[model samples]
Target: MSDRRLTPELLLGAYAAGVFPMAETRDASEIFWVDPERRGILPLDGFRMSRSLARRMRSGRFRATLDRSFPQVLDGCADRDETWINGTIRDLMLDLHALGPAHSFEVWEGEKLAGGMYGIALGGAFFGESMFSRVTDGSKMVLAAALDHLRRCGFTLFDTQFLTPHLASLGGVEITRAAYRARLARALADRASIDAIAMDGDLQAVVQRMTHTS
Candidate 1:
């Protein structure tokens, strides 16, 4: 393992090498690299939108946006008691965004941020870093938009890094590192443009598309 600092360059390099960085705690100044034996990923074409979530999508109570409120989204993800996002990690992600290697999706209700997610985009792979929700179903709304956008953009992989119960409910699954590497390689071989798709944040439209394709 290389003792590289968590600079933008190092972070990008780590992702390129199929590893990611994490801090020990929210207050930790130092960061470490992670390459888990079991990797969590959401199938772009297999994302599950439950009947209730689909109804929520049709409710039109929330709105979603891409690459908006990125910092706020990052902060929201790290707002919990235990977090790996420290100041250094935050700055690094911001730098990645500036270079167009990172992107975010945000959910809003009126003027307040409801939920959002951010990640690094490389070729056809989207490495999900984190997400949060303030209101009910906010995170789900943001995820729906993200999945739609990624599919429309021709992305082939949605790497969540690890699976949680919440993620599993949305069709997140675990795969061995070898399997993940194979998928990553294939995804990295293909290229997709996230900017090519013009996405509407309207919940109904998002669900309509998801239902039609999914």
Candidate 2:
């Protein structure tokens, strides 16, 4: 193992290898690497949108955009009682975002940010780091947008890193590490981009594309 430091290059390499960094808590001084034996992944082809959520999206009460507010989105994700986003991780993410391997998806109601998610993209794989919602179903809405965006961009893998009941409810599943590595390998071999999808800040397209894909 290397006494690794966090940089855009190292971070992307870690992701391509099916490993990631985390802190024990928001205040932790050191970052640690986690390569779980069981990895959680959300398949691009299997993203599920419940009927009510789909209705909310179709109604167009909220709007969605990509890489619009990377910093705010990261802060939102780390704004919890306990978090893994320490100062070091925050700085590393900011640097990565500036370098284009990172991306953010935000849901909005008028001028207010309702919810958002931020993650890293390497080749055809997207590592969904964290998310936060300030309005009902906000995070979920952003997730739907992200799924549609990735699918349109020709992405093959979406790694959530771990599963929560919230994620599992929306088609996220766990695979053995070996399975994850195989999927990761395939994704790393392909090429994709967030902009490869024609999102164009169209909320309706977010719903329509997801519906068509799912």
Candidate 3:
């Protein structure tokens, strides 16, 4: 078992070092740091909005917002059957949120919270921690909006920790540890904020921008 006690300060330091903590299971008592040989990252300017995602974004059936309901978004992500977000990690993330470096991007379907994601933002890097969806295409739309927001906010790096099939489909790529550190150093040298740009605009604008760029 890890003897290290995770504090908000330590958590931030770990992220700065390009490592993150995870638990073996949702109920695990200890958290271990991960410094993967291959790191997954989504390029801020390279996120792909497929035809269906673009259509859904312009559908006007969903609305997106940032930091609207952070705790709710965290809960949604942790609600899955298998998760690494143990109690210790969850509470510490809450502490980080209160300290101002953590944020959530949410997608809503009318009165219901459809999907969202939460992550830690440091310098120009956004470490995507977790995401969840309750409706079809909910998570996809949220990702599209989140990437758009990141770019508009001047963020340069979007760290996904590890690549998954879903993320690869959306443009997440893996880099060797040495390569990732080079990118991370550059991102850390720069500064950015999630709220630097207002996320209050027509969702179609995001779709249009992605159509041109992606």
Question: Would you estimate the TM-scores of all the predictions?
Answer: 0.95, 0.94, 0.96
Q: What is the C-alpha lDDT of each candidate?
A: 0.88, 0.87, 0.90
Alpha carbon lDDT of residue 78, candidate 2?
96
Instruction: Please give, for residues 1-214, the per-residue lDDT of candidate 3 as tens digits.
Output: 3334778999999999999999989889888899999999999888877788778878888898998899999999999889999888889888999999999989998979999999999999999999999998889888888999899889999999999999999999999999999999999888787888799546788898877886
Better of 1 and 2 by lDDT: 1
Q: What are the per-residue Cα lDDT tens digits for candidate 2 across 81-165? A: 9999998889889989998888899999999999999999888899999999998899889988888888889899999999999
Task: Compose the digit string of candidate 1's lDDT tens values, residues 37-135.
Answer: 999999987778989988987886788888878888988999999999888888889889999999999988887999999999989999999999998
TM-score, cand. 1 vs. native = 0.95
| Cα error of candidate 1 at position 47, Å | 1.3
Q: After superposition, how far is residue 85 of candidate 2 from its true place, in Å?
A: 0.2
Residue 39, candidate 2: how far off, in angstroms?
Answer: 0.5
- What order do candidates take by TM-score, descending? 3, 1, 2
Candidate 3 positional error at 43, Å: 0.9
Off by over 4 Å in 2: 1-5
> For model 3, what is the alpha-carbon lDDT of residue 128?
96
Residue 164 error for model 2, in Å?
Answer: 0.8
